[model samples]
Target: MFQDYLFFGVDTKVHYSYRMLHLSHLVEEAKQLHNLNTNRALLLSDALLGSVLLSSILDYEERVNLRFHCNGDFTIGTETSFQAETRGYIECNENSEVVKQLDLGNNIIPEFQVRSMRSQRKKPNLFEGLTSTKANSLEKALNEHLAASYQMNTVLKISSWIDSVSGKLNAFGVIYQELPDIPEEVSIKLKKHIDSLPSMKELFLLDNDADVLSKKLIPDITKAVKSINPKFVCSCSQERVENVIVTLPLSELSDILNKAEDLEMKCHYCNKNYIVSMQTITQIYASRNQVNSTNSNEMN
Candidate 1:
């Protein structure tokens, strides 16, 4: 059983906080949900891991938002709530020429968007940038986005891979940030050391130990912040789908009813199917008419 969570340690002496993520299980779940092939799955797994790492720095009650508009076959998006629940989907044209580019390891220059939603009532603070994706290396692109768009001093390393025999997917990642008080010399040293460290693929396959990895990367840590396990969870439900179906144009609803066919709605996030019976549509139509009549009578 693969455990998934984000772990953080803060060194007041160095004025820096270190974070690590072990998310093999979560990545597997997400790939299965999206039905992605190896390359596509690797790309999306990297994005999801980055989203989770980014969300960790959010203030209380804030959520992480990420979007990608690429000149490729598909547009991908992911969101993580303040509570660590994540959902995402990919939209694509079946016969898009960009699909060939994606398969051939060509650069698909993607416009990346990142943001933090403070609350439901307030507008989200947003950041955007563009990067040329080189196969499976999203960390480099995301790091550039952070530096160019947000001007934050942070370093991230990611690794996502699939088993050749079983086709099982896994991911591991790390992020280190320099607080305002940290001296430039210390930051530089840490960054150089982290950059020189072995890739996540090598480290994960050699020894999947978080504590050992932390000590090897950053030898100083005065405190450990809270740790959390994030999961891929969709927010769709049968009731929500039903409410949406009832709001369709009356003519459309009547046509479905006349055909005596049950309407099926598949959620993009989880691919769960919801069926709406004609009887339910009829009841909803009647209820809508009654409310409209009542409002008109009150106006008179």
Candidate 2:
């Protein structure tokens, strides 16, 4: 059976601490909470390093955020899952040549995803580990992500196969968390135990199943894996983007009008952009003025 709490070496070094999470339990909660498929779930573990990111957002909660930026064949973005599972995706100017010019230096094929963060804000964003090359290793880049965006120190060692060749879905992962309250001595023992563990890919494929593998790795980790959660959710619509344009200052709305007769916006997480005509802009500006005027009078 998989054991979560264990010892690596003799101690005086034996100290008391609580850190780490059950990968299976994490996935089960996700399944019960979302309309997802078990077959499509992945643990996304940095198995080499022993860590994972865990997040859950309700239909209308403003707590979830994701950003994507990569200089590769694919696009980049950030998104949120809102109430009733409604979601929103955002990204930088993807149409430009900035992607093609990336320089990956002596690293694995570049992959970037700021999958988790300590908090979400509406301020200007800072790009982390954006390689100067066409590609870099996905895991190393993520190390930068953990440090820069998440503001949480992490070590990620991910190992999973990528096979676009077969056109079949096949990927599994695991995430190990280190609780902040863990004392330094206990931390040392845990790290040593983690080091002695087998490779994640081998551990990930134990007995031909991810859940089974999770058990094999930490049978007593107090983990619960009922079913896997559904990912690949997209919730973008024209009305939402319209609401965004309406919030812009009248001058900003007029500026879009000056540049062109219409404005186009897209969801970065998914490859969907929208077109706003001059008439649409005019009405948005008009509504914005009304709201502003009412606020002004109320203030007086």
Candidate 3:
């Protein structure tokens, strides 16, 4: 189950700085993730997953992360920004070797199931991690992370789901923060409302939109307070890749030249390739000292 996608869209540089996105309507079909085709249903789920994360970071301007780890397959994990509109990936291998990088969209998932296993399996990057199994859902897993790690004194949850017949997707998530010396009645009422809300998927599936969901759960006192528009953005580029290669030690460059007549590198996130032929390599090495001398002269 999912409801309308909602977030506070803030662009302080603009005239109308912000507005609330219903995420009320999504394209009938799913968007492509790399070369893979994502189902509309799955896209909605992914969007909701991104939305909840965006809200947490955007509205309060806090540094937070939602990650996935388990004994199950598809250990794709992502962490969002505390500063910019970005996210990063944590990639893993069969032997459970994990590596972190800015390439996140490449982390593929096979199936949607966050189920509990018996006998308590133990291993690295496990036991303390969280994830959602139902229809690839992710909100509850995030809530648990906030509660367990930050020991946050707040109410937050992301409820998302879609209908089986219509195939449309919707999502809504709420986060509440407290100020020191906050009112006792406010805290008590907020807690009750949070407890009374329906399952996140249910909230998204049946509700009108994010606003409706919020009103239904916290009928009286809750305020629009803030909203944000979550976007699917990545940080990868051709120039950055070039800078990396150019800065590598000459020995590493020599190795590549010795092994192959041409040197080629592909960006992991963008899949764009850069190729340097043996001729270029030879010329570059020959002129290396001269080029450095000229650059030094220019600097002085």
**Which candidate's TM-score is highest?**
1
- lDDT (10s digit) by residue, model 1, range 1-300: 457878878875858877788888887887887787776777788888887777666555356667765555576777777656787776766677665666565645444443333343155545344544443346776787666555558878888888667778888888877787778788787877787889888887777777776676675655777788888888889899998976887677767778887788898778899998878888887887788789999999
Output the lDDT of residue 22, model 1.
Answer: 81
**Model 1 misplaced regions, further than 4 Å:** 12-14, 104-137, 148-152, 164-166, 242-263, 276-300
Q: Which pairs of residues collide in model 1?
A: none
Candidate with top lDDT is 1
Report RMSD for candidate 3. Answer: 11.1
Model 3 lDDT at residue 246 = 68
lDDT preference between candidates 1 and 3, better one: 1
- Candidates arranged by TM-score, highest first: 1, 3, 2
- Candidate 2's clash total is 29
Cα lDDT of model 3 by residue, 38-145, tens digit = 332343444335434443533343333444554343343333343323332323353422211112323334334232111121323222334344323355444544
lDDT of each: 0.73, 0.42, 0.44
Candidate 3 residue-wise lDDT at 228: 44
Clashes of each: 0, 29, 21
Q: Give the alpha carbon lDDT tens digit for every residue of 168-222 in model 2.
A: 2233343344444557665665566656667555555455444455444442344
